[model samples]
Target: MPTVTPKTAGPDMSSPKTQILAALRRASWISGQALADAAGISRAAIWKHIHALRREGYTIQASSGRGYRLEHAPDHLSPEGVHAGLQTELLGRNLICRRSIDSTQNLAKSLGRQGAPEGTAVLAENQTQGRGRRGRSWASIPHGVAVSLILRPKTSPDKAPHFPLLAGTALARAVSRVCGIWPGLKWPNDLLISGRKVIGILAELEAEMDRISAIYLGIGLNINAEAEDIPPDLASVATSLRIQAGRKIDRLDLVRALLEELEAAYYAYRLQGFGPIREAWKEHNITLGRQVRISSGREIITGTAVDINEDGALRVRTEEQELVTVSAGDVQLCPAV
Candidate 1:
């Protein structure tokens, strides 16, 4: 079963409470009869919704005769709300939302194959089966940024790996811009904040073995969730923007900025090749010039990221006097190195 995101603030929009609140917002002094009729629910249901909305920080005025008045509504995640918060045309032109999903990336891939445009986006409040690189799980903290962008690129299959690196870099830039914290790229797709994992990105592409069809880029960031909110396994490593910025950020605003950066970085990557994107990636990369270990399949290669190559591969100069290019691997830093 798909996970249902608990309503930490307001009631889920799909719930009857939101219907009551929305009705109140639509008209003042909404009579119980009117509200119930409008919502197609019982009068008792109307009262329940009113009480629930009030509990969720909605300022609802109630009167014996005048019925109910909605003074304020809890912020909603409407596409119009998110897009209005955005200033670019590259990230969220088309949006799809699900209450629960196995994975937003899988959903986005389905959309991409059906000819969803370049900026098509799929977002879920929670994921039942969210994943990261190498098929590892990414714990989706409810109300954070769990998004998948489906893009149909004009590039070949061999160059697809570079997109993950570029996407990771774009996310780092977006987080820095919104939260005012400098994050580092661990490799192709991990965001480190204060030397701990804060974000996970996974890139999946559909191809005909040699030609590319579409790419499903997934990014999951910890936001608003407290330190204790992280699971026991990730608590020691993963961090959230709220934890770092000292406040809950407006997710809509941050998402807008992230998509803009992704679009621009993707454009640059296609136009000028990975050289320029690599430079941008290196500037925010903490692994560069630092001692690190790369785990590829089974063998472990330790070295410094003297440079990232034109193809987005890491060029590590090992202590064994071997300069190795690892296309895909797990990166780690030796303690004290």
Candidate 2:
């Protein structure tokens, strides 16, 4: 029987799978002889693998005329498909995906605590108890993206706050590549589209007083959610990419791009720190010049959003000309009065 990759295990990751998927993408149908040559397997072996894939829900149309073609992929999200889609190294090397879960973030944290390697990823097709920053309820409709990543870096624990900033930059790049639309970063980790909330990122850090240990960066993106699927309360505040782009998208493609984007940015961050990504983030940020009222811990401060500090904190210049650095806070963009 073909093995079904665990939700925590992303894709097959075998070199042969990559070659086969790439060939299938280029040509709809190919002869078994050609497949065997490309995959470097015997014709009989190819037949065996094909049968196994079929049992695993892959629709490989086989006949003397058509040879073999992918008619329907399993309604399931295979780690192999995800691995084939993600043409990167290290980032998605450890993948755990679930068909339905309460929270990928929770699962990711458990895995992270167990010393999961860098680039460990957790994905779910549906999250029953998804959470955004500050315990905000996140919607996880079928086929929407609810993912969490575990990053164990050797950076200062103080600098862990910037992980979300880096993630926001990566997300902007990812969304732009797929949707052909520019998304703006708000302050720390919120991805906004036309002043509305489209993506929310929660960065959970586990560390001591001095150095940091690990960071769990969970991202909740509104992908293909119908307007009606959104909660009535968030109807005015939230929007989906499909609703914004006026079309459906290939989830696998977007996931692949996002993982690769995160990988590249993360590599740079660990190598040279947050210089380049921070600069890029500043360029695409919409909150810098706007008026924002921040709810920090208990005290709320209202001011003109000037810039982010080097430590990745939100800086607000108040009416009294005092600038304060906000380490962690909930942001509320004050409407024009």
lDDT (Cα, 0-100) at 73 in candidate 1: 46
Best model per TM-score: 2
What TM-score would every model get versus the actual structure? 0.77, 0.89
Question: Which runs of model 2 end up more than 4 angstroms from their true locations?
Answer: 1-19, 55-58, 63-66, 71-76
Q: Weakest 10 consecutive residues, lDDT, candidate 2? A: 1-10
Worst 10 residues of 1 by lDDT: 1-10
Local accuracy of candidate 1 as per-residue lDDT tens digits, 1-337: 1111221222222345435555675686889998887667898877776776677567888899898887754453546345543444556668876657889988888888778888788877788899988878878876676899987788788988888888877888788888898888878788888778888888887888768788888988787788778788877787888898899887766876787788778777666787777778887887778788888998989887787887888889989878899898998866662
Question: Per-residue lDDT tens digits of candidate 2, residues 1-337?
Answer: 1111223222344556655665565578898888777777787778777777778877888889767888866545567677764657777678887888899989989988888987889988888999887878887754578889988888778888888998898888889999988999988789989778888899988987777778888988788777788878888888888888888866777888888888778878766777777797887798887889888778989999898888998889999999988888888877766
Q: What overall lDDT, based on C-alpha atoms, would model 2 receive against the true structure?
A: 0.79
Task: Quantify how close model 1 is to the true structure by its C-alpha RMSD in Å.
Answer: 8.7
